[model samples]
Target chain A: MSASVSPDWIAVDWGTTNLRAFAMQGGTVVDQAQSDQGMGGLTTDGFEPALRALISPWIAAGNLPVIACGMVGSRQGWVEAAYRAVPCTPLDTVLTRAPASGGLAVHVVSGLSQAAPPDVMRGEETQIAGFLQLNPGWDGVICLPGTHTKWAHLSAGEVVSFQTVMTGELFALLGQSSVLRHSLDPDGWHDAAFAEAVGDTMAHPERLAARLFGLRAGQLLQSTDGAIARARLSGLLIGSELAATKAYWLGQNLAILGTGAQARAYRDALALQGAHAIPADTDRATLAGLTAARRLLREAT
Target chain B: MSASVSPDWIAVDWGTTNLRAFAMQGGTVVDQAQSDQGMGGLTTDGFEPALRALISPWIAAGNLPVIACGMVGSRQGWVEAAYRAVPCTPLDTVLTRAPASGGLAVHVVSGLSQAAPPDVMRGEETQIAGFLQLNPGWDGVICLPGTHTKWAHLSAGEVVSFQTVMTGELFALLGQSSVLRHSLDPDGWHDAAFAEAVGDTMAHPERLAARLFGLRAGQLLQSTDGAIARARLSGLLIGSELAATKAYWLGQNLAILGTGAQARAYRDALALQGAHAIPADTDRATLAGLTAARRLLREAT
Candidate 1:
């Protein structure tokens, strides 16, 4: 597929820990590749080299147009794509030009930022744009579950408001680094424990800090299994998040943009609360968002 | 202070990170010394050597009595000093004996445990015993601030119930290991920011996970100072704790058993809520608790 396809353009999702590039022939993907040289571990000058290393085979000819999104445009990334203030559409037509070599024309998509509540998003904005493009005229809460989970309220094709929660990050830190690490089995899961803990924290969200230490104590006193402890930990963190974001998900048309076990956990949690959330694949949303950005760039030019 | 004193009985406070010993001449501290041989890094056979290294000078003759408290008595320490159930005094008159060398008879103080809520404490029980001994017949809530901050309610001479929060551990992980580390100043302190954040989370404790990501976002969008961010993180964590344990602190005679900046922070946070928490020295409490344990051992023998 790589040798047979002479890509017209490239769709790049360059986030903190990964760099995925898709060779595009018009509206379809011809070939794809990914690398670990994401914005996180690279220096200012390393972006161009990283991109060339991944997509150089597809860029056989000169003057290849490239559309990039996520942290690649962050302040610490290859180039700083300025943040567009929200209460507007997720995508901006005016793409930020990044200095490139090997005859590559790199245009980075801008991130979205909220002023009052002091929230910001880089990679998730593209995913939101893609979700909106895939399901046009959609106006509801779109939840993007990841390391930094985002919940955005959409109205009239615009992001009216949104909030970011560090649930995934908290789970990782607590399960891996905190005293709870000793009690949690990394690969274990218990459905009943998860549901019970979710219900417990949802009802008494203020008791989060108090409840956390119980996981460790449970192991010590009752010999609670690592699987039960793991599930309970996940439930406690997610439950607190759900309780906080009740204004966004309660009685609203919701779609969660993720495809992994984490996404399933969110769905299961919401289901326990009697809310059914439509699942959307994150990769599809990202590609759709980048495609929408590609069209916007073409229209502006 | 070290060479002049030949101690009658030694009081040892061995926790997860530090080992401190006090040379006691019948209820009074003659000389005190400390080492970095905490229980966290020691093997089963290492506890005796660690303890002897620091107090070998004081133990000129064989058969010196030692009363030790904290993690040194846990299942992972020199020996397991079984946890005493609640509705009982913090320290047990019947102490666990660790295998000692050099003609030493080492007695370990028993920790307190709660069955319903599933809580456990090691060293803090000793501090509570000391507080009870010093303040005689004290009935109220005792707050011990550290890695695992404990809040215990006392009625008559028994611990009615207690709760533990990993507020200090959370602060360390979020500030030093999480993404928030980039925006936090290790030594920075902002009194107003701390107070404001404490109030914010106290009123809305469920929003902890949602509010945490804002620290990183605050740094990105607003250039929030490291000091202010650090203080806010502390406020957020502590405020959530206060919210969860409102049952223990509200309208109760409260005393905070700590002397460090962390103890003062708890005091100031409570002060903001118009609740005054009397400050107590932790070292004094430890010594007093150990002395009490010594008396218990004498009576038992």
Candidate 2:
């Protein structure tokens, strides 16, 4: 808690819309801070200054070893950390060193990419690595629900393959921008409505486009509650995603990674289909993954 | 057309973001005008002023009967014209009259609504009516592609049932507002890519949410052209819609009403499936439908 005491290394999770930094002392998070200056907003030159602004107070005499992940390592990030092709371990031993200001020595963790399906992930690879770290040799699927939800097939300490579903993003766009926006209340939810919609869509996923307008139509004709509509919308998308990835989660050892409602919704949706998923903390996964990346760097060197 | 040339009647096509007025002189359009003052922008009081701004010059001492359709008849429009429940004619013999300024008498044509599966259409009903008027005793499906694409089953001069698919809106939202926005060129198109994507999704509609991210991923990994990505996005959504509405168009008398790129895409997609759809013009449908409403008004008087 004391500013005078310096951290051994800093862990950074620089994503599209937010930058999160954690001061790590012997693999434990000593202090954590976040900023709005994420990878999407910053130019190449702006990254170091943005990083310095947040972690400046914790900097000491010796150069602080900063391990970063997510979009910060993307092509548009501070430095391009080429994605490591998957069917390999989530974390690569070799780290991409980045230019940093005085008192900071930065290394970026590479993302994972799949060629056949043409999918790429940055932040989630680190999270997967952390999950694997906590449960060494864990096999099966690790579902990460967020703006761009990723379903990774893990086996024998390697990410076999993964699929990305833009469910969260679709939900946001439809609920905020599309005609459905009028019928959906941002902060409303109905458990029964959600469950029913998930069941319906999973049974007939092709009818999703037809069902979307029903949310608005229902509100207009039957005076359906906005909360119910919102829940149904969420359920419909999640159900469609579930229907698509039936090969990934059906009868597989499943664990959903995240501490957010999106993760919870996914877990609940799967539960409706009689599949139980283990809940994993996102922050813990990110921190543990970053720590694992740092270990990999040390081993490679 | 001169200022002295007054219209026998005015046909109004008012939707969410647009208000179009056609000067109809004995069933022919003498002149046409439009404004951004759509139903979405105007209140009860604002509608008359907005309507007058474009048609004030055409107003004469004799009252001009205005027949209106679309969102202008919605609850939020100038006057609420209650939806005429379907399993009946698309155009009702009765029309709801709205309060208007001197020298202008306005009548709102009722939209069609289905009770079960719950759906509603305002302006499209007019198009369907127009189509029905032109092709009297025609039975089968009428597909109107737009922001809210409609597929209606017509039999015995009545709309047996109808469904609305938000495919167009989804395409717009994903291409313009979602992460796919980065990989899609607004004006780009790839015919082969679109056809392939349509086939892929028609075969696997459940994978839609998953495939959406591929547009961006394909760009990131394979340097896929934005135009190709754009076409693929459109194809994916339309393909999903087609997959859902297989019941409506498979081995049925199909007529597509619209004279836009979207309508053309729908026809092409259907053609890919070996279903030949007769192309119909949207403006003609709307005008014909409004004229039918005017005829009904005259008969009622």
Candidate 3:
């Protein structure tokens, strides 16, 4: 197939399990495409082919700068993009640009990491950079809820400090794979149970282990609906996260960057605590981040 | 395939994934056989076939009593063996006898369930009943650690109360399926790291979410050994469980009824907390429980 559009730049967010590319003519998005050919699905050599396949139609006559984010930059991904330690500007952070091996100029944006306690994030940093680019100089907390939900503190236009919670992953595993799966209704949800569980867990998190089993017991004994079980399970995990991250969310300017139901869940969770979180589009944030990174590359040349 | 050996009575412990039958001429186990035809792998009508396949020779001259326990009694199992409510004697608990089918006397032991802050245990109850039989009049707490680890309090031969934690399942899902899989050596383990994680989590149970992510961060930034990561993962999970169940373990005469490396890990974790836990064989517990229940059936008849 011939090139669909003559691309000036390419915006790619290659995560562990997903590869998304937005072809740009000038500085605007002209065409976009994605594939399941993520870093986790490819070896060291598979990254280039996977990328080319997704954006093959976007290939221009000249070398097109491809600004990529997410796990595609990890040591286990295409090219090893070392993380820039925190207390650094998310946008100004060092970018690991892989040399043009073919017709593509690949720049893998560096992720961010924390010292002392030790924490790291790969693709989320780019999203943060994009969020910062759009919001500019807006300081406080930005809660990015996803598989490894990130809470970043931004000030002086930099990620001051951040934390991550495995809430989404835990929910997926417990809901679908664990014994809790028996009692959970994957398609059903009860908001009241969710709010109650959030409040209860946040109050007494020491009972986490006990309460998790309660979901099953309640289903067997009290004839509790699976919807309640699913909601409570989600609430308990997210609630516990909120309890631990009280330092980050309490009395702060909060905005949640997520897409679809997950973002809504986080927004609802925050509302339960009397904190109204402004919702932002995650895909838009990624596109914006990639666009900004490509601009940085242009200026550098 | 012919009968390996003739049998008198059969001792069966049919779990979710495995079926083991001890052909007993008397109280002594004369021959032992097992199959992968656990309840989870069979349907209601398939149970009889599965049993006969495991112990075809043990059919005997007459209808030999086959006492079974565990998730084999679950609603989804062969026959719906209802759960006996708690605050009852573990050994003297009710046994649901399935009707004579295919010339086999099959009796499925009832699992225990707790009310108020509900909780349930299917297989562990049998293990507890067995533990109680051998350690007659022995009071205090017995911790049976597995996929869903159970902690039961015994007083005056009655299982006063119990709680379950999904620690093993959580560890398995996180290590094998979650993002932490990257930083983990699935086959590796370290004692010191495990102990340290146990102590840390136990001391600060509130930091559970934060500490969980630390496992991944430590691996990436600190070049942490996978063994340490594995041990720490186990420690963090088990430690948090202990912290929640502190009411049951602290200053309590505790015995860990488990087997293999996981049991040993529990022993080590307890030892770190200035508590020396006595280890008991899980198989022996199941066998003894079934034998005791079978004898009770005979006396009642």
Which candidate ranks first by lDDT, i.e. highest? 1
Instruction: Give, for candidate 3 chain B, the lowest lDDT window spanning 10 residues.
Output: B91-100
Each model's backbone clash number: 1, 0, 1
lDDT of 1 by residue, A1-301 (tens): 6577677889999999999999888768888999999899999989998999888887756657899999999999999999988898999889999998655799999999998788989988889989998899998999988888899999888999999998898899999999999999998999999999999999999999999999999999999999999999999999999999999999999999999889999999999999999999898899999999999999999
DockQ of 1: 0.86
- Predicted candidate 2 versus true structure: per-residue lDDT over A1-301, tens digit per residue: 5776669999999999999999899689889899999899989899998988888777745668899999999888998999989899999888898987563689999998999899999989999999999998789999999999999999999999999999999999999999889898889889999999999999999999889999999999999999999999999999999999998999999999987778889999999999999999998999999999998888888
Query: lDDT ranking from best to worst?
Result: 1, 2, 3
Interface RMSD of each: 0.8, 0.7, 1.0
Prediction 1 TM-score vs. true: 0.97
Cα-based lDDT for every prediction: 0.92, 0.91, 0.84
Highest DockQ model number: 2
Tens-place lDDT per residue, model 3, B1-301, is 2366466788888899998988886667888888899888887888888888877776645667788888888889877777777798775535687655766778888888889769888878778878888888888999998888899998987888999898988899999988788889979889899999999878877788877888889988998998899999999888988888989999999999988889888889888999888889888888787888887777877
lDDT of 1 by residue, B260-298 (tens): 789999999998988898889998888999999999889
Superior by TM-score: candidate 2 or candidate 3: 2
Candidate 2: pairs in clash = none
Candidate 3 deviant stretches above 4 angstroms? A1-7, B1-7, B92-94
Better of 2 and 3 by DockQ: 2
| Location of the lowest summed lDDT over 10 successive residues in candidate 2 chain B | B55-64
lDDT of 2 by residue, B20-71 (tens): 9998986899999999998888878999989988887677456688999999
